[model samples]
Target: MPIFNQSIRRKIVGIALGLIVLMLVTSILSMVMSSQVGILLDELTNRYIPAYGHLARANIRSLERSVALRRMVMMKMQAPSEEEAYAARLREFEEADRKIDDEAEAARTLINAIIDDSRTPSDNAGLARIETRIETALTELRQAMNEDHAKLLKQVDDKQMTEVRGTLEHLDTLRDQFNQRIDTIRADMLKQVFASTRTVIGRQHQAIVISAIVTVLAAIVGFAFALLVSSGITRPVRLLLAGTREVEAGRFDKTITVSTQDEIGELAAAFNRMTEQLRHNERIRETFGRYIDPKVVQGLIDRPEVAIDGERRVMTIMFCDMSGFTSMSEGMTPRGLVRVMNHYFTVMSGPIRGNRGIIDKYIGDAIMSYWGPPFIEEDEQALLAGIAATEMVDQVPALQKQLPDLLGIRAMPAPCDLRIGIATGEVLTGSIGSELMMSFTVMGDAVNLASRLEAVNKVYGTRILISQATADAIGARLELREIDHLAVAGQSAPQPIFEVMARAGALTGAQDSLRAHYAEALAAYRARRFDEARAAFNAALEAVPGDGPSRTMLGRIAQFEAKPPEEGWDGAWRLEQK
Candidate 1:
C-alpha cells in the first residue's frame, strides 16, 4: 500500500526486477527436474541395455554348444577313424561350453553391479531377484551338462552306439530347459527396461507441467501486485478520463480530484485548471451569445482569424423588416412593443439559423443574416436563403396569432407582415468596426441591394423579393415571379428582381397560370406592345385577382401608353431614392 505512493519509475523498476527473478526461478527449477530425467536415461542406457545384451549373448552361446556337440558325434562316426577332426570337434565343443559360462558370468556381474548401485532406482530390486533365479538355473544347467558330456564321450570311445544316442537325447532335454529359463529371465529384464523408459518419459512430462504451473502462478502474482500498487495512480486517471468525456459533452464544470503525490496527481491538478479556464470561456460565450449568433460566437472563439482577417467572398445576404412594425409600435406602449419585437425576432431567427444562415445583427425591427463560406457552402447560400425567407413567411401567421396574447390586446391594430429581401453577390465579410468596438458583418453593394429590395417590397405589395443573382442561383427551387429589372438607388446597372411566391411545389394551379401570363405580359411590355401586354396582364389578373407583379406591370404599361419610352430604352426602371 505504501509502495503505491512511490513514483512511477520506482514502481516500473520493482515490477521488472520481480519478473526477472521469477524467470530465473522457473529456469532453475526446470533444470533441476531435467537433471533427474538425465540420470534415469543414463541408467536405462548403460545398465539395462548392457545387461540385456550380455543375457542375449549367453543364450547364443548355448545354441552354439548344441551345434558343436552334433559335429563332435559326426566326427567320431567318420571313416578311417578321423582322429584329427574328432580332436578339433572336441576342442570346439569345450570352447562353446566355456563361452556359455563366460557370457552368464558377465550378465550376473552386471546384475550384481546394478543391485549394489545406490544411484539405481529402488524399482530395480525386482531385477536382483530375477538375477538370483537366473544364477540358480545356470548353476544347475552347468552341472547336468558336464555329467552328460563325460558319459557321451566315454560311450563313443567304447563303440556303444545305442547308449551314446540315449545320452544325446537327454542332453537336448537339458539344453531346452536351460534355454527356456534364460528366455524367461530376458523377458523380465526387457520389461524392466521398458518400465524404466516409461518412468523417464513420465518424469519429463511432469517436470514440464510443474515449470509451466510455476510460471503461470508467478505471472498472476506479479499482475496482482502491480494492480494493487497502481490503484492510487489509476483512480485519478479514471477521474480524468471521465472529466474529459464530460467536457466533450459540453459540460465544463466537472473536475478531477488529485489522489496521489506523483505525476498523475499533477496531471489531475492541470486538468482542474483547464476545466476552470473552459468554464470562464463558457461564461463569456453565454454573455455574448445574446447580442450575436451562437454560431458566430463559437466561430470567433475557436478560430479568431476568420473574423479578424477579412476577405471578399460571394454570399447571400437577407434583410427582413416587419411591414407594420412602425404602426403597431405606435398603437402599443414601449413595454408591449419590446415584447412584440422580441417575440417576432425569436420566431424569425430559428429558420435562418436552422437553414445554416448566420444572423449578422438586428437593426431595430429588421434582422440581417448571411450564408457563405464558413457558415454554409457558396453554391448553397442562395437556395438556403430563399428557403429561410419562405419559412419566415410561413411563420408570420403564427406570429400574428401570438402577437395579441403577447401585447394583451384582442383586435389587431395593424396586420403584421414580413418583407424579406435576398441578394447574392461578392461582399467583404468579417469583423468590421472602429477601434472602440467591433461587429462581425458584411459590406459591399450586395448588402445595400438586399436592404433596397426589402424596401421595394412595399412598392410591389410583395412579401419577399430577391435579386437576379439570387434567383439565378436558386434556380427553380422556389416559386419565383419575375417582378422587374430595376436600378435601385445606389447601383446604376439594372438587375432583374424576382418575388418569392412560395415553396417549389406550394403554388396552386391559379398561381402557376398567373406566373405564365405575367411572364408573357412582361415580355410584351418590354417589346413596347402596350395593347398586347395589357391583354396578357388582364388575363393574369383573372387567374389570380390580387397578383402583385401583374398589377404593378399594368400600372407601368398605362404610364407607357401616356408617354412612350425612347427607342434606345432597355426596359429598366430606375429608383433614385435611398
Candidate 2:
C-alpha cells in the first residue's frame, strides 16, 4: 500500500521526523540550562533575600534599642523619686533589649543556612567571626547599662541626686557603644550581600551565553524544517484565510474550496457549515427584534450573562393611578373602557419613555415604571422619574377632555385626575419569574414604597407624594412642600414625604405662604404643643382653604387634647392601612 493511504496522523509523523529530532535536541539543551538557572534562583530567594532582610531588621532594632535606652535614662533622672513611672520605663527598656537580641539571632540563623548551602562553606568564616564579636559587644553594653540602672534607682530612693546623675551619664555611654557594635555588624553583612549578588549575576551571564549558542543552532535547524513542511500546505492555508475574511465582513454566501484530502479539507468543510449558521442567525435576529424592544433584545444578545442573574442597584420607581377610575369604568361598556385605557396608556407612556424611564407594566388603570442603570444613567434616574411624574400630572386635564370623545359620550360621569408617588432606593432588577414565563422588572422596598405612596395620596388629597430620598435627588430643580413624616404599613422607620408643588422658582405667592405656615404648624405639632399647633394650623387653613394636610393636623390636635399620644411619640403618623 502507498504511504499516503495510511492514517493522517502517521503520514504527518513520517513527514516531520527530521524536525522532531531537531526539536528534541533543542529541548534537552534547554532543560540543562533551566536546571542551572533554577538553582541560582533558589539561592537568591532562600538565602540572599532572607539574609539581607534579617540584617536590615537587626539594624532597625538596634536603633530602637538606643532610643529606648535614652528615653529610660531621661525619664528616670527627671522622675527618679516616682517609683511607678520608673517601673514603666524599666519595662520599655527590657522590651527593647529583647527585640535587639531576637533580630540578631534571626540574622545569625540565616547566615548559618547560607553557609550550609554554600559550595565553599569556609569562605563565610569571616562573617561568622564578625557576628560573634558584635554579639559580645551588645552583651557587655547591656550588662553595664543594667548595673547602672539598678544603682540609679537605689540612689533616687536614698535621695542622693549627685549619684543618680553619674549613673545616667554612664548609661548614655553604654547606648553609644551598643549602636557602634550594631553598625559594624550591619556593614559586614552588607558586604556579604553585595558579594552574593555579584556571584548570582556572574552565573546568570554564563547561563545566557550558553543558552544563546544552543538557541541559534536550534533556530537554524527549525527554520529549514519549517520551510520544507510549509511549502506543501501554503496554497490551502491562503484559500482558508480568504474565506474567513469574507465571512467576517458579513458576506456569508461563499464557501472555501477544499482542494486537499487531509485535515485541511475537513477544516474547510467545517468553515462552510459555520458560514451557513451565521446566515441563519442573522435572519433570526431581524425577526426577533420585531417582537421585542430593540434595546432589550440587543441587550440579551450582547450580554447573555445578565439574562438569568439579578443585580441589586439603586433605582427610582414611580407608581401612577387614575383617581376615581373604578367609578369611571362602571358606566362604560367593555369596548369603551378598553378604548379609554388604551388612549390613556398611549398618552401617559410618552413622558416616561421620553424621560428615559422604563414602563415596567400596566395594572388596569395604574402604571408602574422605574429609572436606573444599564437602562438609564444613575445620577439622572431620580430627576427623570420626577419629571415624568410631573408631566403625567400636567397632562391630566387634556386627558380628561379627550376621554368624553373617546367614550362617545356628551360628558364623562366621573372626573379623572392623577395620583403619583415616586421613591428612590435599592431594588433587584433582572428577568423575574419562571424560565418559561419571565419578565424584566424590579422588585424591592423601593417598588413597594412607591405603591404605598400612591395610596397615601388619597388621604392627603395631594397630586404627588415623594419620599425624602427622591426630593433630595431633585434638589434646586423642582419646588416641593413638606407633607408629613409617615411610617407606612409594613415598614418600621418613618420616612419624611413631600408634595411636588411646581418647578423650582415657579411657586405662586399664595402657595409659597401656604407652605411656610404649614411648616411652622407641623413643627409645633411635633413638639406636642397642641394650643400653638392649633393656632398655626388655623392660619395655614386661612392661607390655603381646604388644605387637606393642615386640616388633618387640626383634627388630630383636637383628639390629642382629649387623649394624648403615648410617651415617646416621634411625631410620625403610623398608618394602619395598606
Candidate 3:
C-alpha cells in the first residue's frame, strides 16, 4: 500500500536513478584500478628496462676494447719496425677505446635519469651510488689501457719485447676489473626490474579483488531494485489478463480490484464498468434472441437504422415446408410429433445458414428464409438461395433416416420430405410489428410468390420450384428443368417456373434426355398440339420413368384433350388452391 501511494512517474524515475548510480559506481571503481595498473606498467617499460639495456651495452663495449688492445699488441710484436702496420693497428685500438668511453657515458646518463625519476628518494640514492662506482671503474680501466697500449706500440717500434709483454699483462687485469664493475651495475638494475614487476603484480591482484567485491554488491542491489520495480508493473498486468479471460469466457460477474492510483488502476476501473454494462446488454440480447434471429438481432444492434425504417431492396426469399407432415404426425404422440419437427428443422436449417441465408421465421412445419444485403451481397443472393435449396433437397434422405429414431419408431407410414420454393425480386425488409413487439422480416410479392411456389411443388410432384426471376438470376449456375408457365392462385398473369435438378451440371446423362423430352412436350402443349405433346411427354417418361414434370404434363394434356379451352390460351394453367 505504501509503495502504491507513489505515482508511476516517481517510481519510474526512482528506478532509473538507482540503475544510473549503480553504473556510475562500477565505472569509477574501474577507472581508479586502471590508473594504478597503468602507472606500474609505465615505470617497468620506460625506466628500468632501458637502464638495464644501456648497462649491458657498456659491459660488451669494455670486452671489445680489451680484445682490440690485445690484437694491436700482437701486431706490433710480430712486425717490429714495420711502422705502417703498427700505425694501422694503433688506430683500431684508439677507435675501440673511444667506443668504450661512449658506451660507459651513455650508461651513466641513463642511470642518472632513472635515479631522478625514482619514486622513493632512498632508492634513488642507492642507484646513484652504483652509477658512480661504474663510472669510476670505467675511467680507471680506460686510462690504464690507453697508457699501456701506447707503451706497447713504442716498445715494438724500438724492438723491446720484454716491456711489450709486461704491459699486456697489466692491461688484461684492468679489463677484467672494468668488466666486474659493469656486471655489478647491470645486476642491480635487474634487481630493480624484478622488484618493480612483483609490486605491479601485487597491486593488480588487489585491484581485481576490490573490483570483484564492488561489482557483486552492485549486482545484488540492481537486481533487487529491478525485481521490485518490475513486479509492481507486472502484477496489475496479470490481473488485467485474468479479468480479460473471464470476460472472454462470457462470465462478466467478476470485477477487477484497483490496487493503485496509476493508469493501470484507472484502466481496471473502466474495465469493471464495461463488464457491468456488457452484463446488462447480454440479458437484453438473451431476451430478444428467443423472438429474433441472432444475426438479425446483432444487425439491428449494429445498424439501428435498419430497424428504424423500412427499405425496399431486391432479395431472394425461400420457403421450405415438410411434405406429408400432416399424414406423418397423425399417429405420432404429442411428444413424438414435437421431437420429429424439431429434428426436421434442425437438420434442414444447416444449409440455409451455411449459404448465408437468414431464417426469417418457422410456421408450423415450414421455415421462411431470405438472402440479401446486410447479410450477403445483393447480386449473389439468388445464386446462394438456389444453392441452399439444392443442399436442403440433398439433405432430405439423411433427415428421413434420422426422423424414425428421433420419434422412437422403426418406420413411419408416411415419410417426410422437403418442398422448397425460391423467388428473387424487390421486397420490403425491416422491423414490422407494433412498438410492443417489433420483428425484423421481409414482405412483398417475392415473399408471397416464394410461399405459393412451395405449395405448387406438390401440384407439380417436384421437390424444389423456383420462379422465373430467381431462375434467370441464378443463370447457368444450377441444373434446371423447365416445369411450366403457370398463373398460380392470386395472380392472373403467367410466370415461368422451373425445378432445380442439381447444383451444377449433374443432370447430363439420362436426366439430360429427360429434360430434352420434357421441353419438347411443354412446347408442343403450349402450341396446342395435343397429340405431339402427349407423345413427347410419354417419351420423356420413358427416359426418366419417375420424372415429375413429365407425369404432371401428361395428365394435363389428357384433361385438355377432354375439355379444350375456349380461345387465347397462352399455355398458362391457373391454380385454384395454394
Candidate 4:
C-alpha cells in the first residue's frame, strides 16, 4: 500500500538504493587500502631510515671538526712567539675538540639504535660499518693530538716537529678513510630503505587495482539487477501510457490488459473504468449536439470546473434572423422547414466561427452569437465579426441558387435576406439554466440592443445594423451608413445605430455622398444648430431617401425648433428603448 510500491517507481527506487550502497562500500574499501599503504610508508621513512641517516651525518660532521681543531693546535704550537697568543689558540682548539667528542657520542647512540631495530641483514651490516668507522676516527685523532703536545713541550725541536708533521698527515689520512666508510654505510642503508619502500608501494598498487576491479564488477552486477527490476515495472507502465494515449485519441475500444497483480494492474483497471465513463459521456455529447450546438454544450459542460462566470468585457454581439422566416415557414411542411432551417444555420455558423465569434445559440429562424466572453480581442473581434456579417450578406444570393440543387426542393428565387444586428458593450456571459440542462449564452442590455437592432433593420430596409459603439470599435475599415436613432423596444434611452453596407471599397458614390451628408448633419446637430442640421439632414435624404438617421434627426430638429427647447440644449440624441 506504500506509495513507492507503485510499479515502475518501485523498480527505480530499488536500483537507486543498490547503486548507493555499492558506492558506499567501495569508498570504505578504498579508504582502508589507502590507510594501510600510508602506514607502511610511514614506518620506512619515519623509523629505521631517518635514524640511520641522522647518525651517519652526525659522525661525518664530528670527524671534520676534530681534524680542523688538531691542525689549529699544531699551528699554534709552531707559531707561538707570545704565551698569551699560544694560550688563546690552545683554548679555541680545546673547545672545538669538546664539541667534536659530544657529537661523536650522539652519533654512536643513533647507530646502536639502528642496529637494534633493523630487520634486514644489509641494514644491520651498514650500521655496524658506520659504528666501526666512528671508533677508528676517534682513536687516530687522540693519538695525533698527544704526539703534537709532546713535541710542543720539547721546545720546538726539528726532529720532533718532523715526526709530529708525519703523525698529523697520518691522522688526516685516517680521518678521510673513516669519513669514506661512513658515506658507504649511509648509501647502503638508503638503498635498503628504498627497496623496502618500493616493495610496500607495489603491494599498495596491487590493492588499488584489486579494489577498482571489484568496484567495476559490483557495478556491473548491480546494473543487471536494476535493469531486471526496472523491466518488471516499465513494461506494464509503457503499455498503460500507450493505452492512455489511444484513449485520448478516441480509441475507446483499446483496453489495457496488464495482468500483474500489482499496483500497475490496479491502474489498468482504473483506466478501463475511466474510458468507459468517457465513452458514455461521448454518446451524450453526440445526442446533445443533435439538438444544440456542440460548442455551446461543451461550454456548459466545461463551465462548472472552469467556473465560467460572467465578466464585464467589451464585446460585439451579433443577432441574425431570416427575414420573413415566419411567413416562409408557414407555407412549407414541418420537415421542409426543418431542412431549410438546418441549411441556413449551417451556412451562417461557418462565417461566425471563421470570424472568431462563438455562436451562443439559435432560436427558431435566428442565430445569436458574440465576440467576447470565454475569449476576446476587442478591436479584432469587432472588425472580424463586422466583416463576417458583410460576407454572410453577400453569400445570401449564392445560397439561394445552391439550395434547390442540394435539397431537391424548388427554392424561392429570392430567399429571405439575412438581417444582422451588431452591438458592442459589456455583457454577462456563461452557462445559465437548471442543473439538469444548461446553455452557454450571453445576456445583458447589449445583447438585447442587438436583437432590437435586427428588428429595426425591417424599418430601415437595411441588411446589417450595428450600434455606434460597434462602429467605433470597428473604426474606418467598414463602410457604414447612418441608420437611425431609435428607442428600440424595451428601454427608455435611444441609441444611434448605423447599417454596415460593405468594407470601405464596396461603397458606391451615392452611398459615399449620403454618408458625408449624414456626418455633416450629425456634426451640426451636436453643435445645436437646428436650422443647419435640418438642411444637412434634407441633403442626406436627397441622396438616399431611406437614410434612417437623417429622418430621425429631422424629426428631432422640428420638435426642438417649434418650442426652441432650453437655450443651452445640445442636440445630442438618446435612444429611449433597447
Q: Pick the candidate with the highest TM-score.
A: 1
The candidate, 1 or 2, that scores higher on TM-score is 1
lDDT, residue 248, candidate 4? 75
List runs of model 3 lying over 4 Å from the truth: 5-263, 272-291
Against the true structure, whose lDDT is highest? 1
- Write one digit per residue (lDDT tens) for candidate 3, span 433-485: 88698778999999989999999998888999999999998889999888999
Per-residue accuracy of model 2 over 363-420 as CA lDDT, tens digit each: 9899998898787788899888888888888899999999999998889998899999
Candidate 3: which pairs clash? none
- Ranked by TM-score, the better of candidates 1 and 4 is 1
- In Å, residue 13's CA in model 2 sits off its true spot by 32
For each candidate, C-alpha RMSD in Å?
Answer: 9.3, 37.1, 11.7, 13.3
Q: Write the per-residue lDDT of candidate 1 for residues 1-578, one digit (tens) a residue.
A: 56766677887788788878888998899898888888878877887788888888888888889888988988887666688898898898889889988888878787777677776464556978878888898899989988998999898888788998999999999998999999999999889888888988888899999989998988888788777766766788889899999999999999887766677878888999999999998898888788888888877777798788988999999999998878878889889888888889999999998999899999999999999987678889999999999999999888889999987889679988999999999999789889999998889999999999999998888889999999999998889999889999988899899998888999999999989988998898888888999999999999999877778888988898888998899998999886
Q: Which portions of model 2 show Cα errors greater than 4 Å?
A: 1-295
Clashes of each: 0, 0, 0, 11
Candidates arranged by lDDT, highest first: 1, 3, 2, 4
Cα distance off (Å), candidate 4, residue 430? 4.2
lDDT of 4 by residue, 424-534 (tens): 888776567888987666778889889988877766667899988988888889987765556677766666788887897888887888889888888888787878888
Note the residue pairs that clash in candidate 1: none
